[model samples]
Target: MDRLIYLDNAATTRTAPEVVEAMLPYFSESYGNPSSVYSFAAKNKDAVTGTRETIAKILGADTSEIYFTAGGTESDNWALKAAAEAYASKGKHIITTKIEHHAILHTGAYLEKRGYEVTYLDVDENGVVSPAAVEAAIRPDTILISVMFANNEIGTIEPIREIGQIARAHGVLFHTDAVQAFGQIPIRVDDCCIDMLSASGHKLNGPKGIGFLYIRKGVKIRSFIHGGAQERKRRAGTENVPGIIGLGAAAQRAARSMEERTAKERELRDHLIGRVLAEIPYSRLNGHPTDRLPNNANFSFRFIEGESLLIMLDMKGICASSGSACTSGSLDPSHVLLAIGLPHEIAHGSLRLTLGEETTREDIDYVVDALKEIVARLRDMSPLYEDFVKKNRQ
Candidate 1:
């Protein structure tokens, strides 16, 4: 069997050994409900508190402001819904971009159904939102502005710092879905003037089913989950002690080696992009060339279906994605691609290969060679390619 070259780090990551080691203690010998008042339980509760503090320190937020949740989707949903409800009296208007994750897009749709108005700003050809566009969309009734720190599909990093400043100057709250950007990039919520931020554990080589939302002090957000008094009555349910501990461990590890890891990933990612474009015909790279995530490399191969390409890559032991893992089953082209002005046919052929800390130059070489061969074979069988070639010959 060929060695598996896993390149789909944006979807999720393999849990680090350190994270697993940190979590094991809570799952067995220290298996106690974090909300319990008993001594054994109190120890677990302390661990949860410590984890919150660790996460807060990483994000430059206050310990009391961090609220743990199931994952990024939940955190995003909570931020949009809770803020809309809490500020309904002040205004029912929200602002975001067209390239956001479905977590933010779908949540915005839900708010619209409940009488809230949402303005979705457009992105440029490189899948980048303009800060001026955000400011122009702001209405007097706008209560909150939500934008993703980085796009999961195209890997385009938005102008979040400028957007954050716009929101602050307008006196509207700002929230960012930082699930994809949190571990890959350095984020200081205070420096960016971000009022709220959301992140997930699995995206950062930590255990799944654990994430956190950072709410700046005095931000009016209503209860997300209704039940016990966990998360200081903001979020409900007993805490996942093991998951939290693992997330903290993962966060610490990521912060310590972020600079070195990012530099290496960027080098490999750029090399892959350059090779694929130079080797393949009619291939176009997606997203901003220099401003995108260090680990993400997305491209569209003309005349082939993305699903077919993904299947071929999988058979070659090169795991890649057509787009977001959440939207893989859909027959329609990626919304992110369409928003960036790609035609339907071009959008349908997009492929994403996200790198990780463990990805090596050898793996990149193997995948690049595999992709070139696959694209050539796929194009040979494609009637669209034949027609395109014939038309160009004229």
Candidate 2:
């Protein structure tokens, strides 16, 4: 284990060196509270404000529309809960896809417990939610529609613009969990009709404690935390000034390097997929092939368990995931895989390898060679594969 090859960028990325450097001053030298009204604290306050404007500009949103939060979970929880509470008079129903991250799914379930009716729409085998199905699910009581901009597990980019259009036509607030999509892809809130969007800093080479929620003008959702007048009185707490600055720095870097970075990633991603499918037995690709994220490649191999594969990869100094890092503890087959029509067995064998900017062609070659050996070894030990081989011989 002289070296580590990390392929789980969707879980979280290593903070960029430049972002870390940008954050250093806020920790010691400029360690003044942004909430402090003194002239001495103005630098920290200005830094926070400037970071907000930076994030807002990336989303094509107004500077005032962005509200900083602890991370993606808080932003998502705030969006769904606050929207339900704020617009309760209009309706008590919501719409979302079955393939959403647990942040969105769990919040929907909590709302259901509190008397909100939720419609969990199914996706096609490629993990694509139909905008028509979303429209069909809308009822007179439908008040909100929350969908992820991309599937965290499979990396299938969703029809955000189309769904956003549908929500707008019906006067429903649309919120997208852009935790995986932000910084990795181009998203213009105004162009896509996104009323609310959630993103995490850690997902894009920034500090883990900071994230932002974009709320369209006039959409007055209730405040998430309730102690101080931070985040324009919308979210309460002392700002993580270092985290904010780090996130801004990361956002700028991601935007500046997106085209070049993604081009290299897409080339490597395809190479990895091609080698795995061609060299391995009983392997199938997951997610939409062309429509997926440039840096993601998920696969399902017959007759082997995902946990076993992950463990073996770990032994070889490689890191990967069976699904999302959030739900890695769960024993049940992924609801997302089930939503996309995978049986429990095949879904149980899922492997998700999301690439990062630091990944190299040599890295992918190493991973592919490792997968060939691991999958072959795992399948050899399986009774299912043994039976299949005997059947073919007969």
Candidate 3:
């Protein structure tokens, strides 16, 4: 059997063997609830605290500021909801972008139902929201501004530092959904003036169902989960002991190898992009060419539906995605692509191939060759392509 090529890191990454090793102990020998008062549980409790410190160091945040949650979605929901409730008196208005993951977009909608106002800023053709646009959208009643550090679909990194500075100047809390950017890029909360940030373990080669939110010191946000004191009483409920251990180990590894890993991935990603665009006619690369994530390469193939392409890739043991994993089953075209000014037909034809630490140049070359064949085969069967060719020839 041929080696499987996994190019969907933006959806989730394979858990590192080292991370799995780190987590093994807690599932059996060290299986004690962190909240228990007995001596057996004390070790697990300390492990949770120690892991928090490890993640805190990665984000340049204090240990007290990190709050654990289920994953990125939960962290995002918590951040936006907490901010809206905390600052309701200051103003009920919130600022975000149209290209945000549904986590933020849906949360904003929920907030609006509860009497909060949300202003969604528009992005450029490359899916970049300007800090000036963010500032202009800010009203006197605006209490919080939330933007993702990087888009999950297009992979365009946002100007978070500039936006954070604007939020600071206006005395409004700034939060970024850094789930897609946290381990992939360097993020210093203090340097960026970020009040809050979100991250998930599965996005960075760690165990699933564990993530953390970084809340800057002195931020007056309310508790997300209301239960027995956990996460320093900021987030409640018993902690997932093994998952936290795995996340800490993964975070440590990612921070240590970020530069080398990303450089290699970027090279392979560029190679794939170049080959796909050159070999496949009528294909266009999406997102900012230079400002995109080191591992992501999204494209739109004219007249070919992304799902059909994905199905063909799967048969060849290749894994890719049309858009965000959370929105996989939706029939509608990607909101990110639409927000970036793509027509509905073009948006529906988008493909997202995100590289990872395990991805190799050989794997990329195989995927590109497979893609060329698949796109060509699909286009041959497409009526749109036939009509396009006939119209152009005439």
Q: lDDT per prediction?
A: 0.94, 0.93, 0.92
lDDT by residue (tens digit), candidate 3, 1-394: 3779899999999999999999999999999999999999999999999999999888778898888899999999999999788888888999999999999999999999999989999999999999999998888999999999999999999999999999999988999999999889999998999998999999999989999888888888999898878888878888999999999999999999999999998899889988988888999999999898999999999998988989989999999999999988899999999999999999889999999998888899899889889988999999999999999999
lDDT of 1 by residue, 274-389 (tens): 99999988999999999999999999999999999999999988889999999879999999999999999999999999999999999999998989999999999999899989
Q: List the residue pairs that clash in candidate 2.
A: none
lDDT of 2 by residue, 128-187 (tens): 999999999999999999999999988899999999999999988999999999998899
- TM for every model, in the order presented, reads 0.99, 0.99, 0.98
| Candidate 1: residue 365 lDDT (0-100) | 91
lDDT for position 49 in model 3: 92
Q: Could you say which candidate leads in lDDT?
A: 1
Residue 268 lDDT in model 3? Answer: 90
Query: Model 3 Cα displacement at 278 (Å)?
Result: 1.3
| Clash totals in order | 0, 0, 0
Give the clash total for candidate 3.
0
Judge candidate 2 at residue 269 and give its lDDT.
96
